[model samples]
Target: MSKIYVLDTNVLLQDPHSIFSFEENEVVIPAVVLEEVDSKKRYMDEIGRNARHVSRLIDSFRGNGKLHERIPLENGGSLRIELNHRSFQQLQDIFIEKTNDNRILAVAKNLSLEEETKEDGKTVILVSKDALVRVKADAIGLLSEDYLSDRVIENDHVYTGFLEVYTAKETIDRYYEKGEIQASEIVTFPLFPNQFLVMKDALGSSASAIGIVDKSRKKLKKLIFDYDHIWGIKPRNVQQTAAFELLLRKDLPLVTLTGKAGTGKTLLALASGLLQTEDHGAYKKLLVARPIVPVGKDIGFLPGEKEEKLRPWMQPIYDNLEYLFNVKKPGELDAILAGMGSIEVEALTYIRGRSIPDQYIIIDEAQNLTKHEVKTILTRVGEGSKIVLMGDPEQIDHPYLDAYNNGLTYVVERFKDQMIAGHVKLIKGERSGLAQLAADLL
Candidate 1:
């Protein structure tokens, strides 16, 4: 007997194709889930797009049979809409609320109880992205699990975009003298495109060198900007040196930087953007954008005009800009930015319809973005544009996103092997001792 997997509304909103994730098992969708999806269908944001997508997908399934009954899915499983709310009243004794979450849990509990009387009783598992819903289900003696199909890396440690290997001291010297070496001669492990490496001496000597694999994955080349200062900010460590290698490379169109707070992810990206666009004359402009989490499409709640409403959300970027420009006045940086048409800071809200070309784009705090939201932003990159997405996967603000499942993590894993894409994970925080201590301890 196949197990029954009941889904939550968040699961569908996170991934519209998640209904087919449970293979060869019964997939149950509570009626309240559809109602919740309906309420969000007009949201005009990522959730809204996902809600509309789910609505259309279910409507197309009607051609097979009625949704209330078992509808055979192509994955060898059946989909059903549970219209009964028999367990809702029982949950009131414990939950004391009639929210949609409780309603969905009640449906799952009702099915679990009904299956217990059968000779070939099937196991019921409630799958939800919400932790509280699972807790409520556990209180009612029901089995529950997270919907983890969207997770990029299932391990505790995500892909760090770099590797450390112990090589013979001779190999390190030879690599430095020749400026490049055959990747097979260094390590036995598989080499990925643009994968940064820190080669250490195996003889217990104090010798080390940094390099990265080319797109062909055959040669390891030394860092190009290892010593040069990028817009008055030099590489403070080997990680930043590796980052500048990717950031200044016009050949690579996509770059992702992930690290803890105060690690200079945004600072380095801004410095590079300024150097390339203003000094090198590589791109036309520097465009910076980040998501306004929790209030994604509903910025009307904040008072003032569009720019005023966005000030709070965009302050972090401005703070970094001020540090780079050394502006002592309150609006001095703003005035300089206004005069310099080459730099633009804006929210990710209206980025859907525009085709950004010949620009250096930076998307900070990218972990707050959903997969769909990031995909939309990525598709807007046009010819001659280089997009840098940097964030701490450990710090996510989206309710439905976790460390390994947000847009930044998703893109890091998905594009790790692409020739045009590169990634670097900054470990040490260069901001300050206090900030680094807070990032690690607090």
Candidate 2:
């Protein structure tokens, strides 16, 4: 049955081409939605970019036909601008205020209640990225849905990159004894490149050294760095080892690591980045960045230059760098930073419109970012650049976000198929005993 879908501003902001997402369904853009999109189009962030894109998309569609009137889409659907909605009248009867949200709800309600479009009593459905707007639409007897066009992975189907397979005890023994085996001779059913196998002896014997082998059964080389002793830092766990592969792989331009606190996600990424950019000549510089998420009610003002103002948000990255450098004094690390001139700590706020190539980019605390924000950062990566996104999804602070919906998880889910991307869910915490216990218990 043909139904009209009234789009909210957030849907367009979440995905600019959302109009084309609903296959064969009529798309209706209330005049109020344009007002909202117009307000956000001038901002200098991802939302603004998407808003402008949506405006341009609508303008392009004008060449097809008048948007104010129904126009046939290439797909078996049509697009139209709904300018006759009387949401203002309905909302005035209840709230008596012409609020933007109320006006949008009224548009949806009017369309949904229109008798001419009703089919078995279902006329229209509203799509939005804003939860409040969906709730308001439902309250006014309008069908509503969240705009999930940007969601890359379905619930419970995200790639883990590891598989549990039952293998013969004799094969496990031979693998350890020979230190290498033929891939075809092995009975492991599923194996991915660089994937680790526990190889538990079915008969129960202490036989295990983490190994990754190629299809030819040859042991693949582990990640090695040229800087043997520039700094005494070492990877403390398997998660860090896997992270090193993602951070150093020139072929893999995108990497995402998710785990709880004390999982060594940030430390390993930062350490490997320092090794490649500072110690080795792999890249020209190391760029470390994180989104600025206010812990509580925002103070709304800070006085200083970019670095000083960014200090409050970027202090955690600085702390990890200080620990890696083993500096004793407060300003000692700053002096080292100045001397290296190869390591940079900046906020995501200023990363837009910059071309970053031949650098190891680490984006910490990535769980607070949206899908749009993540896309913006990934698109800015030029050739010969590796971008690593690390964050604890459970520790997300964005109000409109959750563990499953944040940018880090979205990236992991979307780019799973690309050979150039790898994802790791750090299970163990190697930070400290207390930190580990706290992470587990809390």
Candidate 3:
């Protein structure tokens, strides 16, 4: 039996193309969902952009039939902006308010009852990205689920960008002696390009070697910048060494670093960017940007221009910079940043419609970005530009994003096999003992 999938406003705002995700099944967008989406068509953020995109898409679909009627999608399914079944009579006892969420519940609840009387056994399920909406659906006896089409990797199988393989003592010795070895001779499982491998002795000895797979995936070569200190910062572990290799390399323009907080994802990227820009003169400037997704209550409107307004959002970047420069006095970091005209700290919102060239770009808090938002940023990279995207995928602040589907995790998986990309997952937290314990236990 075919199912009827009702979409929430957040589902469409998360992925505008989600209307065609259901295969050969009816997709319903409650009328209240449109109202919610319409209310967000301005303000110029990612959500507003997605709202406008969804509006254009539904308008394009109107060529076939009216929105209230069944509009045939190209994927052999149908879309209908449900105008009926919005009666709050059934929900009056349970829900006190007539909010948009309640109205969506009303539609889904009524659809289930209407479908139950049919001989076709059509099941009704409300597809929402909001947990509370799904909970309300269940409280009112409705089957609901999260939109899963954007999940690139499962939760347990999150990509760590590296693997451990135990090999014979001779193999490890030969690799160290020769500086390279054929990957097929050692790794029995599938491997991707630029994937770091830690070769340990199968005899349970203390001997171990680390190397990254070559672009051809046929050979594993030794790391180039493993032990070197860049910008007075040394790698505390093997994962950080691998990240430095990717960061300093001019060939691989795209690098991704993922781990819990205090793994030094932002610090390492900044150090490498500074090394290449200030010492090596590899790029013209160092550009750092991050999405302004807050963790808790926002500070509300600030009274200043763009740079002053962005100071709060960019404070973490400044903190890393101050630590790197060993600034002791108040506002000393600001003076240092002003002296070095090559360093630019910016918010990701202004990055649109820009073509950045000959710069070392770092996007921190990348876990808050959507797939489309990441694509927009990546496409801005011009010739001689290298971009590093670093974030803790497990610590996302965006309401519509999770670890598996955020932009950082998406890029890590999609570019794992690509030649221009390299990724590392920093497991150890180097910030402090308490920080590492909080990261692991709490």
Top TM-score prediction, candidate number: 3
lDDT of 2 by residue, 223-325 (tens): 4432333246566665556566566666677888888888887888888788778767899999999998887788677899988899888999999888889
lDDT of 3 at 254: 98
Regions of model 3 farther than 4 Å from truth: none
> Against the true structure, whose lDDT is highest?
3
Put the candidates in lDDT order, highest first.
3, 1, 2
Better of 1 and 2 by TM-score: 1
Give candidate 2's TM-score.
0.84
What ranges in model 1 sit over 4 Å off? 89-92, 294-300
Q: What's the TM for model 1?
A: 0.96
- Candidate 2 — which residues are off by over 4 angstroms? 88-97, 116-122, 164-166, 182-191, 213-237, 245-254, 352-358, 368-385, 397-407, 432-442
Candidate 2 weakest lDDT stretch, 10 residues: 221-230
TM-score of each: 0.96, 0.84, 0.97
